[model samples]
Target: MANHHIDIHHVAKLARLKLSDSEAATYTLQLDHILDYIAALDQHDLDAAMPTAHAEAVFDVWRHDEPRPSFTNEQSLANAPKKSQGQFQMPRVVEE
Candidate 1:
């Protein structure tokens, strides 16, 4: 287990969270415990093991690329911040 004190306030600020002093202390301990658990993996010898994303065999089960019904132009443009002539309007992206 790692013996390091975490700066909970810094973490909370970065995550845009407003944590009280008690909450910060609680989270600090919880985060430290999680990190200590992860550090325990260092004791394992993983040289012979193959890295995998999952423990079991996984195959791509993809749906066929076929035409399907989609939202209409009105439905698509309904949420546009700025629109004109049935299309999204934005500042010019290129200069002549």
Candidate 2:
């Protein structure tokens, strides 16, 4: 992806950043290191590598979803800190 060098000043301007000389230098070095690492990874031999979703084998550990008994109104509101007319109450969140 990184075929060309990154222009730190151009990138800063595009991002609306007002980077000082020191900041630009630091970012340039960091970007160069990242691109160099990617270049190194590009040298790997992967012709025989198989595409996979995960590095290790994985399986579904979830349980079946089945219908169950429902809770009563009172049971559902048992732990409510504030309730009115058997319903939970909270601060108004909407505006006119």
Candidate 3:
């Protein structure tokens, strides 16, 4: 439903791209041809076709959530570059 000629120029300007005159002309023709093909497809009748949610039928594919043991504070901080009071320490992140 969109005009490809003006759309190309608009997109190029928004993206701060500079295309040669020859390149713009070439792309305009190519894009128009592609849109024409899509327009041709719009004439097909799909009124009786059933809409599909997915390409294939899905089965029970989810994994069951299970509880697992987690590392303690001391174990988690064991490999840190620096630690303080049983916790990992890092450089200040914010500046005044």
Candidate 4:
């Protein structure tokens, strides 16, 4: 795949494409047969292929940080429409 010579009208003038010299000779022979089938898959020989990031031996189970309780600041301000010294006030959303 590195013998590189693919100028389909300079790649349709860098993708602002308006190609039609028979669509740049049919996309330069369909990108030279998909780059000669990826140069025949670069002469295939993966040396017993086994370099995986994730073909699913999945992980990240995460749950055991241990802190189980419940809320109480006066039962969480009991449904505040504007609490003050214990918190939940909302209205001065940044302008300055």
Candidate 4, 14-92: lDDT as tens digits = 8898987887877787788788778876698877988899888879978889997879887898899888999888989
lDDT of 3 by residue, 6-94 (tens): 47788789989899989887787888878877777569887889988899989789866997778988789889999898877898999
Estimate candidate 2's RMSD in Å.
9.5
User: Candidate 1 on 1-96: residue-level lDDT in tens?
Assistant: 447667889878899999988999788988888887787878999989988987788799888899989999999999999999999999999997
Backbone collisions counted per model: 0, 0, 0, 0
Ten consecutive residues with minimal summed lDDT in candidate 4?
Answer: 1-10
Off by over 4 Å in 3: 1-6, 14-17, 47-96
Can you list the residue pairs that collide in candidate 1? Answer: none
The runs of at least 3 residues in candidate 4 whose Cα sits more than 4 Å from the true structure, single-residue gaps closed, are: 1-21, 28-30, 51-96
Query: lDDT for every model?
Result: 0.88, 0.86, 0.81, 0.81
> Which one wins by lDDT: 1 or 3?
1
Candidate 2 Cα outliers beyond 4 Å, as residue runs: 1-4, 44-96
In terms of TM-score, the best-performing candidate is: 1
Total backbone clashes of candidate 1, pairs 3 or more residues apart or in separate chains: 0
Which parts of model 1 are misplaced by more than 4 Å?
A: 5-18, 69-96
Per-residue lDDT tens digits for candidate 2, residues 1-96, read 445367999989999999999999888888977887778766889789888988787798876699778899999999999999999999999997
**Comparing candidate 1 with candidate 4, which one achieves the higher lDDT?**
1
TM-score between model 2 and native: 0.37
Q: Distance from true position, residue 89, model 3, in Å? A: 27
